[model samples]
Target: MRLGQRLRTIADMVPIGVTMADIGTDHAYLPIYLVEQKIITSAIAGDIHQGPYLSAKNAVAAVQLTQHISVRLGNGLEVVKPGEAEVVVIAGMGGANIIDILNSRPEVTSKVKRLILQPMIAAALVRTWLHTQGWQIVDEQLVQEEGKLYQIIAAEPGGSPVVEPVLYEIGPLLWQSKHPLLKLHINELIGHLRGVILAMEGSADAVKLAKYREYTIRLKALEEKIRCL
Candidate 1:
């Protein structure tokens, strides 16, 4: 099975020989690819919608991996039990939604060895929550697919005791190591903030002015960080 750049990157992050539960698995492509490559011995492909659930079921059957991949119809991580999977992957969802899913069943998540998250937006929130929950973000990858930039985060148990706001905004691992894509991503963010600042230039509202000032300061800080890199 051919996986897209985004899914392929996420799949590469999964450790070999570990069972994984792919939550909200739209087409079950990731699990199917992993099993076919013998990267993971087994996987549980779970989905909340019937359409995707049936699609996943059919996909697994077509691949002749019925015994290795279990197609489950459920919401979030509710389909799997503790100790059933070593890793849990929740991708293609918003950061807030991912946090809610993890929060829904702490018992199951607490037992898992690692979590691979691919938040569609508000990724900073996911990072912040991970830090607070004691899940250390071990690695991150940034990829541009079809003109859109995507961020993938891998976290495990035992995180840092401190969760800085800047770390959440800039990504601790990505910023500290200065990943190749970090400068580009930061430049994009600076552009966005500049646009916001420009939009708020003529506003008389105190709130808008306050936000403009804040964004200006953030833009300068991001530029300085990029320069240092």
Candidate 2:
């Protein structure tokens, strides 16, 4: 099972030595890769749906990693207890869904040393919610996979946080680190912004125009922020 470079990079970013859990483990690839590489001693491949759970179970079995990898069918961290895992990886989901999983259980949140999040979309919402909850993004990575750019953020609880308004749009680490691909992604977003503003033209409703006008302003401000970047 060859994981793509982007997903493989996310797997690489996992703490070199620790027990971790992969939530919504569709094919259980991350865990299998980590354990096979001996980076992690054990992992819990958990998912909310039966299809993914069974797929993960079958994969784990085929790899003969059943002992090192446990496949459980459960939602979020409801199946994980505190102090069991030091690292958690949640990927291929929306930011809001990840936030919901984090907010759903305090016990799981309190025990982890790191959270590796690779949201498919709504990353800004996830980053904002994490900042509001006092989590610090320690590091991040940017990669273009299958024509779409994705950001992978690793965060931990505690310490002073700095979340600028524009941080949500471009990500604090991406802005601070100035990851090269970030510029390209921002450029793409600016193009989208232009198209959105163009689409809003000829709308007669005052409320609709007002709402879009506000969004346009926000987009322009975001454009300026990127320009500065």
Candidate 3:
């Protein structure tokens, strides 16, 4: 019950009895919590680094859940075999890193039923890759922790895309639902877009200009939407 707000938000997306692989699991709190709550019968607590893996091992041992959870030392999904995990939870890392992990093991995506991701940055890039890779975005949610907003997406291996490039930029599902945190998330995005636009404007380089212009078009639309807020 005392779980951190961020972990709790991530935990809400896990369905009962689904085997999970917690990539970049620092102390393996998510898998431990899920196993204790009976939401997951088995889980793999994976960390690319040995320090974190040892920490996860100690934590699982503390909970007497070493049997239910397997803490493995390896990078990304390297410790997980194909068809091993039904649900893959990748958290506590940037979206780019998460994308790299998935990209490295294309077969892992094909084998899993669900992917729950919480990206520190570049979520749009992750969403973009998911779109091209035939992954379907079924659910999207946001949470604010210590003045920072985090986006968590629940996606599968295949489906029609409900979001466009701009939506990916603004998290279409979050905008449509009008979640209470949308205003904050939108404003931050707008600021980022504006900064990018301004920096691009100062540069006379044509290539950067064109790239910035493209981003500006989306930013302007976002600016207008945030206006009503």
Candidate 4:
């Protein structure tokens, strides 16, 4: 099965011959591809909504992978039991929501060998959560699809904390490796911060002013990072 650039990047991070669980699996594409390629022995494709649950069921059936892949309708990691899967994949969601899912089931998440996360926004939160939880970022990938850029983070147990605040926003590994998309990502972030600053210009509200100053500081950091890049 052919996967999109974003999903393909996430899939590539999965280790060979492991049991995987994919949360919010839109159509079970990722699991199906991995199972078919023999990358994973089996998988649990889960989604909170019924439509996606049925869609995943049908997709797995169409490919005659019913025995290898189980489609379940549930929220977050609730679909799988502890020690059921070696790798857990959460993609195409906001950073906060992803963290909630992980936080929701510590038992399930704690047993997992690895986490492959793709946060749609506020990736810094996700990175911070991982660091605080002692999950070291093993690898990071940046991919652009349909004019939007996505960050894929792969983490495992026993990682060090990220000391620099800006490094959390710009992935430490991505910065160290100088990913081809790093400069573009930084530019995009700078653009977003600039837009926020411009929108809050002249606002006297204490909360707004405080936020404005925060954005200004972050914007300057990003600008400095870009210059070095």
Best by lDDT: 4
Model 3: per-residue Cα lDDT over 167-206, one tens digit each? 7877767877888888889889888878877777776794
Query: lDDT per residue, candidate 2, 128-173, as tens digits?
Result: 8878888888888998888988889889887646666667867888
Count residue pairs with overlapping backbones in model 4.
0
Native RMSD of candidate 4 (Å): 1.1
Q: Between the candidate structures 3 and 4, which one is better when assessed by lDDT?
A: 4
Tens-place lDDT per residue, model 4, 1-229, is 9999999999999999999999999899999999999999999999999998999999999999999999999999999999999999999999999999999999999999999999999999999999999899999999999999999999999968546788899999999999999999999898888888887775667436667778888888888889997
How many Å off is the CA of 31 in candidate 1? 0.3
**Candidate 1 lDDT:** 0.89
On TM-score, who's better, 2 or 3?
3
* Overall lDDT per candidate, in order of appearance: 0.89, 0.86, 0.87, 0.93
Q: Candidate 4, 18: how far from true, in Å? A: 0.4
List candidate 4 segments past 4 Å from native. 206-208
Q: Model 2 Cα displacement at 140 (Å)?
A: 1.0
Model 1 TM-score? 0.90
> Sort by TM-score, best first: what order?
4, 3, 2, 1
- Supply every candidate's count of residue pairs whose N, Cα or C atoms clash at under 3 angstroms: 0, 0, 0, 0
